[model samples]
Target chain A: MTPTITAFETSPDRGQGLARDMRVRWSLEEVRQPYEVRLVSFAAMKEPAHLARHPFGQIPTYEEGELVLFESGAIVLHIAQRHAGLLPDDANARARAVAWMFAAVNTIEPPILDLQNAKFQEGDKPWAAERMPLVLDRIRQRAGQLSERLDDADWLDGAFSAGDLMMIGVLRRLRPSGLLDEYPNLAAYVARGEARPAFKRAFDAQLAVFTSRQPAAG
Target chain B: MTPTITAFETSPDRGQGLARDMRVRWSLEEVRQPYEVRLVSFAAMKEPAHLARHPFGQIPTYEEGELVLFESGAIVLHIAQRHAGLLPDDANARARAVAWMFAAVNTIEPPILDLQNAKFQEGDKPWAAERMPLVLDRIRQRAGQLSERLDDADWLDGAFSAGDLMMIGVLRRLRPSGLLDEYPNLAAYVARGEARPAFKRAFDAQLAVFTSRQPAAG
Candidate 1:
């Protein structure tokens, strides 16, 4: 059975692949799992009907038969567990991989998200200029720790898994600030993720949505 | 070997279990694991030595022999995996439980954390009042989704596991906003978590720090 996931009808990021749904799409692609997307508009998302699937009126809620799930990390973990490639078979390694996944969201993504909130949401505020540095510093701290750990390693723990997939998604949000380039290795890591054939498929899929929304380019 | 975790010498939260370390402490207590705490001053946290352990200068880093880890979610997860109580033996159920942990931090906590940022970090800004509702609405959306699904379920999945523990922790932050009260079921759910003996132990441990910090009454 093909699982269905919700996404933005017209994403705020356009075709940038920074939308949360892109991670779910890329995860499905990575595991070679065929799936369907149910795009939701801003209004539809806030409605009780859509909220039933995702309490938060957000995109990328996954449903398979009776099993409904939200949160891209949770959905990706579920997919990784049900399928083969995204998690290690060894118990300890698997735990470590999952740890990396948690780290990606909790430790790393918080500041990046804060940066977004500061800019788009609070950019015009009196404290925006002063508060921006604190948020950026927080992000840089995480990036430095991550880069130090990654050093020359290909992946955070071992082979590429959902952890790398999530880390790339989180780090890619930093592209707008151009802060990711300050750490050469982390920038390369995002590039490597974008270079993945699965990621390419996922990116193209999202881009198609934006292109489809255009007035037929006549 | 007993594990060692870090905590704030003088927490900004005045020992209300709002510190990240409290999450780790709660997880350890829940699993019946014995651990030690090394309190670091704010200045020490930014020092090279502490930065090596935690680049973000955050509390609650786990050091179990050679396996040193930062990030409360990851540390809590590590303890949960090593100990028996926090996760289930069943494969599918275990995956679902782990998924909740991700949901707690990645999905639920983002808006709550943003609210904190807006109030404490950017409160003086002119746009703070205008932007606050949007963030709160975002939080309410997630709370509403979770509250409906939780309906009458005792826990997120089957029995209480790391997922619920993490979820409860995330939800508890909403108490200050009185938003959880807006959703009766979620309020009850958090109360259930607070009622746990393990949670009490962790809470008291943190509370003790605040009490000890007070000067003796003359």
Candidate 2:
């Protein structure tokens, strides 16, 4: 069964592939699995139908027959588990890959998301300017450690598993912040992930949605 | 060989079980698995040893033979995958449970952490008072949706899985915030989790460490 995942009918990022559905799409592409997309309007996403599929009423929900899942990390892992390409055959390596997936979302992504909240959510707030540095510092702290660990490696772990996929997605969010450039290797790391054929395909797919829906210029 | 995990030498939460190690401990107790603990000081966590085990320098790094893993969610899922208690036997149900784990950490915990950052990390900022309500409201938004889904259900899913374990852990952080009271059902759900015997065992274990290390009052 071709799993159906949801994306924003009109992505706030304007199809930058930052919407989480891009993660699931990238994972599916890595595994060479075909899937379908169900574009959801913001209002419809909050409605009962989408909420039932995702309690938090967010997009990038995966539904295949009876199995419905959300959270890009989980959806990516599910795809990785079912298909061999995204994880290692060795049990220990596979478990480590899963650990990196958790670290990406839990430890790494939280601070990056805070940076976003400081800008998008609290940009007008009086503290945005003052707290922005603190938030950015938090991201810098994690990036420094991650860069030290990566140390010219091609991937976070031994191979390009789901861990790299999620980490790269989180790092992509930092592209606009310019902090990623401060850590040269980490910036290169994001570049390597972006260069993958699978990533390019997924990026184009989501970008097309935004482009095709562009309002005609006056 | 028994798996070894790490914890803070003296937890800042003062045995409140807010530390990530508590999650790993609870999972072990639920699965009846015996494990060893390695206490790392704040400085030691940054040293080469612990950093080798956990790149991010956090507690709750699991080591058994050659397989080392970090991230409480990943550790819990690893325990669940290897042991019988924490995941469902059905594949679809298991996938759903994993998704809930991600939601708890990714979706639910982020807002709660924002509240913490506002208080613990940025409490003295000039805009702290004004911006706290915004952070609090963000948490309430998620709590409202979660409460509706869990209206009458015992757990997020059908049975007690790692999903509930993680969600409960994230919610426990909110007890001091008092915002949990706004959602009565969600509060009760957290209470139900606390009342579990495994949770009690885990709590006591961490609390004992804090109690033993308490500095004598003058």
Q: Which candidate should be chosen as best, given TM-score against the real structure?
A: 2
DockQ of each: 0.44, 0.86
Give the alpha carbon lDDT tens digit for every residue of B1-218 in model 2.
79999999988998899999999999999999999998999999999999999999989899999999999999999999999989999999999999989999998899898898889889998998999888999899999999999999899889999999999999999999999999999999999999999999999999989999988889
Candidate 2 chain B: worst-modelled 10 consecutive residues by lDDT: B112-121
DockQ of 2: 0.86
Best by DockQ: 2
Error of 1 at B66 (Å): 3.9
iRMSD, per candidate, in listed order:
2.8, 0.8
TM-score of each: 0.86, 0.98
Across residues B1-218, which tens digit of lDDT does each residue of candidate 1 receive?
Answer: 99999988886876668777878888899988888888889899888788777656677777877666777777777788788999999765776677788889988898898889878876887767877887898788778778877889889888999999999988888888888899988999999988999999999988888779888899
